[model samples]
Target chain A: MGTTGGPGGRRVGRPRVSQRPDSGLTPRAELLTAAADLFTTRGYAATTTRTIAERAGMRQASMYHYVSGKEELLAELLESTVTPSLTYARGLLADDVTPAEGRLWELCRTDVELLCGGPHNLGGLYLLPEVRAERFAGFHAVRAELKDTYRQLLAATDAGGALAKSELDLRTDLLFGLIEGVILVHRSDPERPVSAFAEATADAALRIAGI
Target chain B: MGTTGGPGGRRVGRPRVSQRPDSGLTPRAELLTAAADLFTTRGYAATTTRTIAERAGMRQASMYHYVSGKEELLAELLESTVTPSLTYARGLLADDVTPAEGRLWELCRTDVELLCGGPHNLGGLYLLPEVRAERFAGFHAVRAELKDTYRQLLAATDAGGALAKSELDLRTDLLFGLIEGVILVHRSDPERPVSAFAEATADAALRIAGI
Candidate 1:
């Protein structure tokens, strides 16, 4: 989504399709879709905004109307993917009633679904070296928060256990790895159904955590 | 190491340091090391042969003596990392005396060691989108073989189990993911000892595989 007026508001970028109801997809959405395709395939650094515009069926100058630049396009794409997951994770962690194990499972399941459910392998974009730039700091911060949420859930689940803090943290890292690992698998074999991976990854996450 | 003339001969690239004596590192090793540093940090596409030569403290024309081009440098880097692991895996899988479970543990432990033992996060190179190109097919083939080794070991361990083939394959994928997951963790916190990650990943791999 394009940034609205505010200090911490979203950054300036093409408006999301949902922002405009009547039209099927705003030029911004088209640009984003094209950018994501190029970024995931040709890579962020290799794919120029001009190529992105061409792929989006727009003139290079007109493409600027939708996006400030390619970096903003990447930031928006990453934010769109990670922000929803962060929200879901925060929501899951907030519910104290559910056992920590169940909460962790739900988080893993939802994350796997998100990673594999998309038309494009959006999660693969995280592998890009450019994503580590200072411009994407906001995305990284949210990602860290999401990771912390996993650690907290894991620690809570291991409460009263003999597992040391260090060991618990390692397990938490492994759990995240297990969940994200599905993206690599999906990349290698996209023909497989997403639901199968989601279900299997959820089960594997619990097993890795020794739940 | 430079490829010898054979069916699977080494491709055109810098000669490894170990291949030479007296001199600490040959110009080829220097170029490859410099290229690896740049590729892992600055990225493959963004890095040029001139920059690689500069980083290696050599003239651009001299740099060509060691490597055919930037792509060859990347090929060598990937081959150096994956080939050794594949060799080790094949050896481990061929040992019929060891139970499949023990073999799997050994495989996981060794893989983790290789992944974390390096000065650079060599595994990080795999994250490059360029690795998917046809030129890097050999690397991908070796990688797939490595994965198959894991799958075979996993299946042997699960012999006669009620677990479906699909479930078994999924577990195999998760096991590989757990071991490779250490690279990402290592990337985030480089200060941590590699041995700790190696041990924890091996253990988590076993746990994920229900060993």
Candidate 2:
């Protein structure tokens, strides 16, 4: 959906597959929805283009009109898990007036909420070895940039002061790990309220930062 | 392999494929090695019995002598990841002398080290949807027991004072998550010395417990 390079884009509408009911989503959105469900519930490597197309209520050939293949669907799905947090993080990084510690807490809360609130545990896909392929370098790069913002905000915190660079880096590893790792917890107990879970995660993030 | 129950056990040796050199492993060990390699590198669902058998230098049908099939391999590998830590945790629970906070720290350090120091990021496989099948219930129960030990140790810590049960559970989730999540960090930089990484993880665990 980005203006530049990436394996995905918005494709026009198409006729439905007779066996499946329509979800009333745009062709591209519908494809992504189908991909998210299949990728998260069925193993990604085991899921085929034909199955995703069938799930989306479209013909296999028509699905190609919307997606290049499974890899593009994966690339886009992985990006979806991180892009919102990355965008908000970029904004927070530029805002000098807000206290860095509070901003860090807010970012952690929002990030965890988004990761946990999703109908699918899309963040779980981060563990896939297939994600290491060149096609996903874009998603990894974006995720790295978001991590850098966390490091910056943590460094600006009172507790972050006086720590050596190595220590800072280590804490950043734990902080970022905890943020993304909440998906496992959320998945185990899907009934947990997202707001309280987010707040708890933010509290733990601050503590991990040695607050 | 345990004396009681599980899908795995030691099997006798056998001749191997001509093309691949001997790994100097027992036939059962060799099969597991091949499985671990294939499951971690190529996606688990993508790897087949034929491929795993060939990689281990045995005929596909002969491979059945050491194992039932792929799901057994998956169950054993998942159990391997947690069993060591779980065993250690049970011992720690019985030890009344060591301070609870220190025991918690040591457990965190050891757990992270075991997870991150592996040749392959076996923890990565925990994300696979297939893991949730009823076949893996034993592995899940063991992991849950290990987590209960973490909860007990954490509740006994001085910093854990006066906390409600819900808050304690949230912190336990964060702590366990960081321990398993370190695999992501270690995977990105495989060269990081395990000792330093483990120590840093222990430090972060204590802080996350509000120390």
Candidate 3:
């Protein structure tokens, strides 16, 4: 995973002997984790690559071996956090067996779990002002796709005439909005357990969808 | 009000003679509006007093006559945006005639209107990374008081045992989460009307509260 023989490439630092194989984290994974923590707490703009390297227990030069730069690190963290849910949402949308309401519930539950159950509160990155820049356009595009999936599922559930065609778009927005609200609340009060909030948010998501 | 006899004070710029009395906005109010627009769109960190002054049609020196600095501009915007809602929530809490469920719905509707009906989307300020800083501690505190009001109302409506005591707090979080979700959606797609979204949200809030 090391970058070598590239422009501006230099020899990265040596790996630490203290790292154990059983620790269940690759050097790259450790860097991402460290980056997520700093990015969420101190914000993406305030955090430096050196700080991330120190947090991950690697030398500054060695950090480049695993990741290209700080922006890439943030892009990676956001993709890792959001892409899995998008993939799962796509899979559910393709599935023919489950009803739309059930699929929506599963999507809400899985999303809440991913957001609330993560070791670091990475979902808070969505609230960062820097993330809205053109450089992070890919992240916003994927996020919009995820929201589109919600719109699809919501339209499916509206087949019973529960919601008018005009209302589907707004309901979709409200549904995801309720689910993502947990991130903001969790940010404000980190000590509180997210399990209860996650459960209640999932329930609220379903209710918002009229399921 | 114009500032006079203050340190570094000077007649900063010529007043626009085109200004009319019926415009119904003071220079300070215009500054606040301009700041909210820039802060919400360009972000607090990226926005400067000069830019805010330019947007509000005043000189940078004159801008100081209205606000102490960018942080104070933000504090003012946040206080203006949130304090009125806090005051209204307090009034509702003090009122004995309205049932808790009705009060919650009213709160949801009023909040949505404030969030969505504004020309400049002031609620987006809540998403800025700068607002999380210690300087804006008062904003977060008052926001908590608003949330607490929701808790009180939710508890009052729990008379029939629809929700257990433990669920009230989480529900309050979800309740506000759902309402505030409108801000995020409005930020994404500003063209859509919020009235329908507000109506659906209020209904969903009541449902989440088990009313």
Top of the candidates by DockQ: 2
- lDDT (10s digit) by residue, model 2, range A1-211: 2123223332422233433444557878878888898899987998889888866776799888888999999999999888999999988988999999999999999999889888888988888889999999999999998899899999998888768998898888889988877877776777988998899889888988987
Best of the two (2, 3) by lDDT: 2
B1-211, model 3: which lDDT tens digit per residue?
3322223422333243223223458878877877887776666666778877755666678778878888888888787767778899999999899887788788888888788888877776675556788999988888899888888877877542466667767778788877776777776778877787677788888877767
lDDT of 3 by residue, A1-211 (tens): 3322223422323243223223468988888877887776666666779877866666778888889988888877777767888999999999989888888888888888787778777776665556677878888888899988988887887542467667777677788888776677766667776666666677788776667
lDDT (0 to 1) per candidate: 0.76, 0.83, 0.74
Ordered from best to worst lDDT, the candidate numbers read 2, 1, 3
Clashing pairs in 3: none
Deviation in Å, model 3, residue A81 alpha carbon:
3.0
Per-residue lDDT of model 2, residues B56-152, tens digit only: 7767888899999999998999899999999999889889999998899989999988888778789888889999999999989988999999999
- Interface RMSD for candidate number 1? 1.6
Off by over 4 Å in 3: A1-31, A47-70, A158-162, B1-31, B48-66, B158-162
Docking class of 3: acceptable
DockQ, ranked from best to worst: 2, 1, 3
Selected candidate, larger TM-score, 1 vs 2: 2
| DockQ, all candidates in order | 0.47, 0.67, 0.39
Docking quality category of candidate 2 according to DockQ thresholds: medium
- Quote the TM-score that chain A achieves in each candidate: 0.84, 0.89, 0.81
